[model samples]
Target: MSFASLGLNQTLLDAVAEQGYNAPTPIQTEAIPAILEGLDVMAGAQTGTGKTAAFALPILQFLSAQTRDSSGKISVRALILTPTRELAQQVHASVVKYGAQTDLRAALVYGGASINTQIESLKAGVDIVVATPGRLIDLMYKRAVDLSQVEYMVFDEADRMLDMGFMDEIQRILKVLPSTRQTLLFSATFDDEIFKLSKALLKTPKLIEVDARNTASIQVEQRVYAVDEDRKRELISYLIGSQNWQQVLIFTRTKLGADALAKEMCKDGLKTQAIHGDKSQGARERALEEFREGKTRVLVATDLAARGLDIEELKYVVNYELPFKAEDYIHRIGRTGRAGGTGLAISLVCEDENYLLQEVETKLETQLPQQWLPGFEPDLTREVKKAPRRNSRGAQKQRARERALGKKPTKRRR
Candidate 1:
């Protein structure tokens, strides 16, 4: 349905329309109404699903309808906690954009910036505060900000926060917040840990899931290349140059690898930059800005910078190194194929990562077609065997019985 039918204020609707959003996305369609109803919500939707606007719009509406404090001091009524500085800034931007015509004031506070400036902004007062967990906790410890009156709280990218090891900080923050406030938890995927945390944090929450796990976006065309470990960089360079690809994202496993790859690509006359946690905030922001503006042809990033990266028309994603966890493979490729747009995801697999690839294929419930470069075919005589699959107790007993009966045991394909 059209965003106009979502009961958004005319000014907010105008803002959305100006942004060229004619219809609500699935996550937005389900989340906006539940949020407006003041119910706790837990949403499972991938990045680039307009999840930010889902909660941002409703929070803006709620804050606008409230009466200002008698002292004319704008105490924060809503707190949005995000995992990364980039995601925090993005959510803050949406809040400001949608609340531009209203009386609400929003501010973004995160690390890698001067705490003095954030403290000054807190003193000036704000209606909504978007922050990272660490910096928010620091501010609260110094009594620089108060959340006792916070009416709404949001944990955007909840799984990412958990991955970053912010569980203690999250619990501490929750302890300080008012128990009567409305809560919302939005994540790309749900695991046992996230489910347990949701049970503790939400009160009979409305559940919204737009896609099932193990389902990658259909808009993405995925391919895998079997290459030697040493030839991966050469193959990547050749592919980009041969295809004249612009705006490609390359993922590496470590910060050093990301930096080295970007440097080598630059040496090959391609504009490139590396973004990771080690880089200063300004450097990271500049790199992202250049990449978004199409000034940089390639951006090499580690896993930390990979999550919550929203780049429009991102044509290609290359997995320079496969993650150890199979689930992360899904997230890596998900950087592309955004917003129902066609994209490509390419993975470079070496001998060492063969088992990782098999695990990933099993998790996806589909076998990936492996392609060999004309001159890069691996040696079949090497006999590289993966570790044997683990068997359950019942399966082991059945296998023993078949062996005793002189019958071959059947293999169960994952």
Candidate 2:
């Protein structure tokens, strides 16, 4: 249905039209009406489902309807928390674009930027504040921003925030917000932790799931190559070069892996750069920008980019290494096949990562086709040595931690 039917005003409709959106996405269609009715909402929608507009449009309309003080002073009325800087910036841009016709002012705050400027913006007054948890906590400590005045609160990418270990920060932020306020949570998936979080925060919220949770976009063509660990780089290089694939986004499990793979690809004459938490914010943004502009043909990234990096018409994604979590596999390939564009997702599966690949297939509820490229077939004769049998539980736990941290196992201290 059209956004107008969802009870948006002409101004909001005009903004939607400007963006050439005649009909609302499923998430928006379900979420906007419930939000306009003043009900708390917990929505499950993957990336590229127009979720930003679902909340932003309704929020803008709600804020615009509020009575304003004649003194020209602005008090924060809404708080939108995101997981990462890139996602924060993306949500902020959506707010500005959709609220362009309204007088409500919005400011963005996140880490790796000038806090002084953010403080200045908050001091100048903002009706809405979109921020990351860490910077928001810093601003609260400095008394530069106040959530006590918040009438509406939004946790965008809630699952990702919790996955990144922001549970304590979320609780702290919740303690500062008004006890009696509307809350909205949007996430790609809702595991037990997210459900528990919803119970604590939402008051009989309307639950909406736009699609089957944690499933990859159907528009993406997914395939995997079985190769030896040492030959993964060679296979990927050949795929990119032989297929003439432009604008490839590659995901690895660690920062060091991202860096090393980018270097190797560049040595193979492919324009490549790596982005991860270790890179300066400026460098990260520049790397992403260059990749988006085609200055860099490949972007090797760790899980830091699994959710937030948005590139329009990004047609190719490579899982240079699979994530430890099956849920993240969905997010990694989501970078491609966005906004109705056809895309391709390829994974290089070595023997050690076969279990990881199986886990992803289980989550997707379908088997990913294995394609063995000519001249890059795996050396099946090379025997792999299994780790020594120990206490299965303790050994598995240690391996799990190492996989999550993207590190090799370290010996225990005496």
- How many residue pairs collide in each prediction? 0, 0
Query: After superposing candidate 2, which stretches have Cα over 4 Å from the reference?
Result: 385-414
Off by over 4 Å in 1: 381-414
lDDT of 1 by residue, 1-414 (tens): 888778888888988987888899999999999999989999998777789999999988888888986878888889999998888988898888888889888889999999989999989989899999999999998999999889999999898898899999999999989999999999887888899989989999999999876557777899999997778888888889989999999988778788888998898888999999999999999999899998999999988886778888898999987776677778778888887788899999877566668778877878898999887776677767454445553554354345323468756457
Alpha-carbon deviation at 314 in model 1, angstroms: 1.0
325 in model 2: Cα distance from truth in Å?
Answer: 0.6
Best by TM-score: 2
Score candidate 1 by lDDT: 0.86
- Colliding pairs, model 1: none
Q: RMSD, each candidate, Å?
A: 7.4, 2.5
Task: Please tell me which predicted candidate would have the highest lDDT against the true structure.
Answer: 2
